[model samples]
Target chain A: MSKLSKKQKWLVAGLLAVALCFGISPVTGAMHIMEGYLPMGFCILWYVISIPFVVWGFIQLKKSIDANRRNMAIIAMCGAFIFIISSLKIPSVTGSCSHMTGTGLGALLFGPAAVSVLSVIVLLFQAILLAHGGLTTLGANTFSMGIAGPFLSFGIYMLGKKFNFNKKVTVFVACFLGDLFTYCVTALQLALAYPSELGGYSASFVKFLGVFAPTQIPLAIIEGILSVIVIIALESYAKPEMRSLGFIEQEA
Target chain B: MVIHWLWVLPFVLLLIGGLIYKAYRHRGEHHHHHGFGHKHGEATIAVDTYAYHSGIAHWNPAFKVVLSIVLLLFCVISDSVEVSLIIICFTTFVTVVLGDLSFHHYFEMLTIPLVFLIVGSVIILINFSWTPMTNVILCLPVFNFFVIITHDSLYVTVHLWARAFGALSAMYMMSLSTMSNEIFSVLRKAHVPALLIELMNMIYRNIFIMADTQNRMRNAAESRLGYVDYRTSLKSFGSTISNLFIVSLKRSGHLFDAMEARCYDGELLFLETEKPLNAKLILMALGVVAYCVLVWVMTRGV
Candidate 1:
């Protein structure tokens, strides 16, 4: 075949641009693996991997509830808060609106274990109600958005505090990294399931990462900034609630 | 061969137009509030709202749950296009015809997952290579590499898309027809832990109240031009979320106090309404299962 003329080359280029735009369209706010998207084996493996964290979260929740009967109500409220946050559309310069993960704030407040439980419930709600995720893929979704993201986010917050970094900046970095890590784990999960014929899992991973990057990066940044603002607002307006949750020191 | 390749131009343009229409139709005006639909003036109440009013709402929750699970499992494991198509049709009949869900709403809900599936399938469809491959649909040359679409990738993408739609419809059948409270009751019957059930119940209940509060707060902010620009919207959203957190804390505390005043114990109990499965429904479910197995066997190795 002969090489294409300039106009034909530009036409091909325009077509490719359109195709890529459609492929990366962030029209849907959902980041979870859709129903039956993964192979059965991957589904079973993810469920097995996620069960322990969910059980541990339940145990922590049990402990807190046993210590105080009111904790059940408080925890439920937190879970509901996470659900509402995820449903809200956040403004981004990327022109693709998406929902907030809200795991960062939940992890910072009630610890990672409890946030895992909260997120599982939220994921279930999304699957059943919003059809954003799926029951079969619930394990994978929880592992990425709940278990992996919040644990790393909490770890960062603790590390930042131990080193005595600027408080607001620490919150921002922790929340931001946590949100980004959640998307990374999601991409990894997708790549594992759909490895390319050419470069196998790693190449597919890069492709998935590239696909998620344009929209998710902005969402992560928004999550970080929103977390900082929420914390500051909480400190000012909800001092008693913050102190009760042991998030703030009690004034003498 | 060149003419065959040129057909892709119109296809791409059509797809672009379809996507633009979809985007315009679902603009963020639907703001996920409690007690409403996303479409213009449609009466969609998430899942529960539909479930409560479904024509099949009185059908046994346990039966619907079990049948939906069986269909979902069959759809995924069978990996047959015929089976997926059958399940999709069956689910549409059940959810839209029998359950009396709005056809428009059902299609809208299906589009939510369809967008994600399309995006994922497209990623799987396109392949990158250093050398040319057989059955190439479109190939674009880059620096020392080629972007290609192969026949094998297209086949895999179509297979996945079919299976996902099948499984998704099954889930919708369950969720769209049965209320969350009913599902919790069924879970309780299946011996799920009481604590987790209670937590789910509370969270489900609180979700509506909080969503309403958030909706009101957002509307109030919008009235004050809180979302005029990106920076202003961020500030408004931040304050709204923080205020929502504080409000939730207060609501939970008051709820606990109210429960205690009403002689509440640590465990929360809900009254379960009994809805038994009829023989006709059982027979129909069995027929559906048999149909799936038959399809799987017939379409094996396709």
Candidate 2:
């Protein structure tokens, strides 16, 4: 196999970073930490702050749309689809239930940019109804789960594609890694914010690993397997739809 | 649970002050964009930014360190309702005064925990377990406060709404300002395990992708009139969810293929964007250490 280029190496690095963060501490729910726990001044500060990145993502989406109108719509539809599916929860241990975020699928399809746009929308809806995550945290949440996750997955996907690896294996690795990355970042964020409460980095990181690994690791593997299965199904049954969505071309 | 008057007083004062500060700041800052007039908007933002930007975003990291240390110390030293109340009141006050948040916001945030506190305290009082006088004194006032303030019932009928919004607001502030990417950089620099770091990155990326897919499916379902009822709609929803899982699986497969094509060898590398630690940041670290020491000294006897 050919060696990775500088860009690919950077991509891998970025992906690994995201996975470690999320895996260490999965951002489990739609809304993370609620309002009024931290000092209110801090909340207002972050709200004003995350605007630039959100705007930037939209601009990127616009450019992508202008470049490929049909593909853009399909991508947008997929994004919307993910938002809806993830909202539905399933029962889990600890009297709490878990739901699928579907971010891994987005990364596999239209790449990370599309996932960014979708994340903003999903978080918006969640804030309105369930109030799981607050409006203030929207930007940060978007940056963490939305922007970082898809980008990492896409980068991994591209690397796998270049290497001529088995298609199924490539997808499995990408999805698993992407799902894991979200949790790791959540842990790190928790460590930073509640260092004393969380018992500093070492303690918090260990606690996060201990708390999340049992649930999240298995969840990642399940998600990865599910993603691969879905892709296979799409290839077989919905080939036309997949092609329209730009998952595959007639030549491939 | 000996609630120290002094300990409780500081906690309440600080909390209220923090809230007021946030509320005041929100009123002055016209730059803030509350897209939907959500309650506790400013407070939420403040908490999110504090969480996200605590260490890296040119802010005083010592503030968070000190605050956490204080909270922990308080938790350890004082285990009484009086102390809890004092801490609650002080924290609420800080939230209101310094944070510039509304009283209603604080009330709403504390509503759930308040209920639990009241019920548990009352039960203890009724049972006459372990110093009935203490229980009666604490329970009556708190219950009375809730009754006078909100006029809610003490029965199971009262909703047990999770304190999700308040908790999320705090969590958000913590996450928004801090860059997760920078965090990984810090971890790697600290020589943390490479495997652990790799896992974190992968999981994070997949969350957004999963969310995106879920969103798309929801829109499609809505367009097709899939969410009107409970039973049929749930079935359809189940199918949709299953379909999403399948789609995710396939996508992951494709991504895996792509990675292999690029010659990925399971190892990840990257460049660092952070500059050398500045004097101010170092000082901030030192300040955190000093605060820790101070907290240790203050709580030594307790």
Residues B261-290 of candidate 2 have per-residue lDDT tens digits of 777555456664544446764574365335
Contacts from the true interface found in each model, as a fraction, amount to 0.71, 0.06
- Winner by TM-score: 1
Count of residue pairs whose backbone atoms collide, per candidate: 1, 175
Question: What is the per-residue lDDT of model 2 for residues A88-171, given as tens digits with 9 covering 90 to 100?
Answer: 553333323445557877778766765776676667545433445545456556666776666777788889889988989988
Residue range A53-136, candidate 1, lDDT tens digits? 999999989999999999889999999999888877777775554788999888999899999888988999888888777899
Model 1 root mean square deviation, Cα atoms: 7.0
- Which residue window of length 10 is worst by lDDT in model 1 chain A? A19-28
lDDT of 1 at A201: 96
lDDT of 1 by residue, B128-222 (tens): 88886655777766556787777777777888988999999999999999988889888888998888888899998898888888888988999
